[model samples]
Target: MIKSWLKEMEAEYRIEILFASETGSRAWGGATVHSDYDVRFIYKHHDVRSYLSLRKAQETMDFPAPYDAQGWDIYKAFHLLQKSNPGLCEWAFSPILYHDCQNFSSKLRRFVTESYSLISLFHHYIHLMDRNLKDIRGKAFTEKRQKQFIQAVRAFLLAKAIILEQKVPVMALYSSFSSSFPKDCTIVSFYQQLMEAKQSGELVSYADIEDAIFMMEQERPLLLELSYGLSKGKSIENELNQWIWELLHL
Candidate 1:
């Protein structure tokens, strides 16, 4: 059903969907099976969509999914895909990819370094951390909500690494109490004990704030440098995108 949706979209509308995420991948790695399948894409229409404004007509298709919605606002897709957001990069690297006819996914991969902004990515992770921490702390101290805390801490830890490295860190491993980072550094080990929690669709709690705090202190300086350096003049736009257009279009 999903495969045909791609052909129909391309055949009928000339719009191309670049990527999608399968819900199952999360399940195998500890997420609930009921997680939504998130999909995203980029497309172009017969030239008009490139410049149309509020007063002008638009070409976009939005439809409901079993667990989510699907649609495309053409230009927004173009810009965001061009910039290579981390979530989008994950979409490219997604184990279960939906469509790749135009070869945009691979091309996008080569240009990702240009799209990354340490400050922007850091803020994204920090906000997630704050929310997850609050949720865990709000719950009564018990093992019931352990899974949520674990997921939160893992997210926080990855963000912490990016802050430390001043780069978009590849996602790390996770369980209820402990998590690992890119290349599998076992900074914590109790993450291995969440097998039962995993089957029950749960996460572990993180009452130990010291590890997270210490990691942050060591990482702040690098993130500060990145934040201070992201300027228009410093944008590596031409070199990065040019490399993409010339090299990876197959």
Candidate 2:
């Protein structure tokens, strides 16, 4: 069912990178808990139709249906290919990809294998760090420190992606970049809160976390300098669209 669905999508859109994440891998320390599959794919247009300039005005598609619990996100491929979007690298090795067709996706799988923009990924991590801090410090009605920790790990890895590789690395954070990253107020604040949580041994949902979240919200705008123009990734090859056309019987 998954492969066929992906194939059908390939026939419809020129898929550049298809990533599957949170499909739940045993090696990742995911317990026997029933986890939903989060599937995200990025596609690009071969024709002139992709340049409509309405990038955020619904040039993409997202749906959730027909599974134990699954998500489908279809993006304009050209949009993400530029600047080595971390989302592309994150999904490429989701440990649960159903299919990859139209050779375009295959190429992206390789291109990303080589390059990813550190600046853009840093921006992404910054936003995520802010979100985590919000969850921990301010009004995160739910106990979200686990997610915050995950974001911190991601942020740290993205910075290393820049420092070590000059581009975003894959979603899985390796030990190579795990030790440290550039820090700001929110980063330090989140770290401090995490330490407090560790020392107090209190429940994760403890109300004392709001301060960190508040600081993160305040520090959100500081990361804009790192994110600008990170989306303009590599230009698409003409052959990739030709492949899509062939698959579509055009």
lDDT of each: 0.51, 0.48
Evaluated against the true structure, the overall lDDT of model 2 is 0.48
lDDT per residue for candidate 1 within 183-224, as digits (tens), equals 354333444444446557654444444454356456546655
State the displacement of the C-alpha of residue 174, model 2, in Å, after optimal TM-score superposition. 7.5
My TM-score estimates for the predictions, one after another, are: 0.64, 0.53
For model 1, the run of ten residues with the poorest summed lDDT? 171-180
**What TM-score does structure 2 among the candidates reach?**
0.53
Off by over 4 Å in 1: 9-14, 21-28, 46-64, 67-74, 81-84, 140-150, 171-196, 202-250
Q: lDDT score, residue 142, model 1?
A: 55
Q: How would you encode candidate 2's per-residue C-alpha lDDT over 87-183 as one tens digit per residue?
A: 5565554555555554445666666655555565666767666565555543434424654554554454455345444445554343222244445
